[model samples]
Target: MSGDFDTIRDASSSDEVQLVRLLEEKIKSLQIEIENLRKELNYYKAEMEKMLSPPLIEAVVLDVLPDGRVLVRSSSGPNLVVNVASHIDQKLIKPGVSVALNQRGSTILEVLPQKEDPIVKTMEIVEKPNVTYSEIGGLEEQIKELREVVELPLKKPEIFREIGVEPPKGVLLYGPPGTGKTMLAKAVATESNAVFIHVVASEFAQKFVGEGARIVRELFEMAKRKAPSIIFIDEIDAIGAKRIDIGTSGEREIQRTLMQLLAELDGFNPLDNVKIIAATNRIDILDPALLRPGRFDRIIEVPLPDFRGRTEIFNIYLKKMKIEDNINLELLSQLSEGFSGADIKNVCVEAAYMAIRDGRNKVTMKDLVDAITKINVKRNNMESMKERREKYS
Candidate 1:
């Protein structure tokens, strides 16, 4: 009886071990299937996202095919399709040849401020001259110097090579507040007949991260591609401020923009045509790297005009104004000492008021004298002038 009980016990123990081994194998197989399902689900989810949300239509360009099939690239990577009813026919822009992408379920567009208008781009490239050299008076030396540097690249590139003097890459017009630095830059654009891109520091700060740097690169590229172009950055200190601590995300972005601008400017070798002209009232506040040899190397001082320069400026402005025979511009130039060209323009405008009050057709010396005196005296005395303007209103 004891031997029989031992055999039964051994059989039971072997059966229990076999059952446990089967259960372990089942669990391992289940885990492998679960992992494979998870990978398959992830891949399906990615495909779904792509179908739901697509990239923005970056650009719309017209492409004429060899077989005469007018095609358009929407830049969104969609198959080209056209709506015959929505197209226009024009010489510059042909429609029917036009196609657009349907932006559906896009999250990227939501991040941007507003939808950009395609029509505005056409207006931007239109060339128009604002102020010509003939419009500016005085500072003949400065104008002549700038003309040679700016115009030679366009008018006579061969002469420039023979002279062995590469046209200046950039010109820095630095001076006291209200000097003719801005005027000088405009004149360069007019005389050279180049595309002008005007940028101020205020505009730089307003741009979003990476946007400013992108604009800088694009503008430089544009200037290079459209050789014989001038890029004028006014009050450069605002954009080119010193690189301080990159403690904040904003600061880091600004640094990135500045570094990109520096790189673009450095890498740009004009096909011997484009030039950069920057102006700053506070040169001391600019970054050291910007003032180095290749960038803004020729720092021209636009000091307060001397007596002769002032006299010439007076004559130019007076040419258009209705002036009496007795208005003696030379005397007015001498009297308006320590004044900027802008200040002189203001004086001329103010003198016109006096002529109007006197019921005269032209301005006179007495009118200017009174205008000068009115400008210098404390504003407390201008109550009558203020009252007159208000009364008229």
Candidate 2:
């Protein structure tokens, strides 16, 4: 009876061990199942959130309503009255502030930071040019006026205030090509150490309607933000041409761009330290309004340099060049009448090239004469072609 009892006790112990092992296995399986369920729940939650999200659109604030709503011009081609989100501060909902709008509800989701317009950003001069006042020659009077008009206003505004006279708002540098109008602007920019933005008028005239005007707005806004800046518009005639009673959509868009530019020049917001310099070869074609006293206070004509001016230009270009001692600049200046400062520089460059081609160390008087003769021949050929075209037309 004792032996039977021992065998039964051992069997009972073994069965208890097996039961415990089974229970452990069941708990482990349940934990894994619970983890998988949580993962599935998370995945469903993400999908639900995606479905709940709405598309956001970009818009520019036009005006603020008295009742606390805002007027926005959507990028999608319509002006809208959108509700500002309750969480957003009302102060940042002012006109001109960019905002993100919910497409479904037509509400401003968030006030967006003003982004730098890519076009205007490219227009600004990132690195100031390596040009200075000394480098510019034969435009002493022009440089003087530019300093007083652009530099003084930014550097010493008190002088104008003390004299009880308002400084010029803008300067126009009109001239034939290569007379150094653009170079003068560069000198002023370097001397004043101000932000220089150089943009061509053709670029300002966008093909799309209202696009050009928008660029003008952003341009002036940027200039204002970067105070004590210079805005040089080369070839102003492209957009500033006289307005016509009737024209194509493209022409109308350019006129619109010009109107925006005029508005900016004579706008209510006074240009404190910002100065404008516009250059054009065809000043006659420009609108009369653009040349007005208030808009462009100084209409400086950078005409062809005189003989003395030519001499100065020659000296400026020849100073650094290695030439024979027999090189008489005054004679060269006299021989090269009607040649622009740029032409004179080109002559010097051509002389250098001739010497290099001949395996010579220094530019000789013959080299200078050869370059001048070569350029004169080219000019004569161009003039003959132009005359033939005119005669044919």
Q: What TM-score would each prediction reach against the true structure?
A: 0.63, 0.74
Candidate 1 error regions (>4 Å): 1-126, 207-210, 244-246, 377-393
lDDT per residue as tens, model 2, 301-324: 898998899888888888898878
Q: Please, what's the RMSD in Å of model 2?
A: 6.8
The local distance difference test score of each candidate is 0.67, 0.83
For residues 1-393, write the lDDT of model 1, one tens digit per residue: 999999999899999999999999999999999999999999999999988875545333233345433344455565453322223332222311223334541211211222333321222331444777776666777888887777667677788778666666778888876668888887777777877767675466564554667667556645554556677878777677786667987767677767877886676553356678888887887888887776667777788877887777778788889887787878988887777787677778888988898788898888887776766563435557879898999
| Model 2: pairs clashing at backbone N, Cα or C within 3 Å | none
In angstroms, give how far residue 117 of model 2 lies from its true place: 2.1
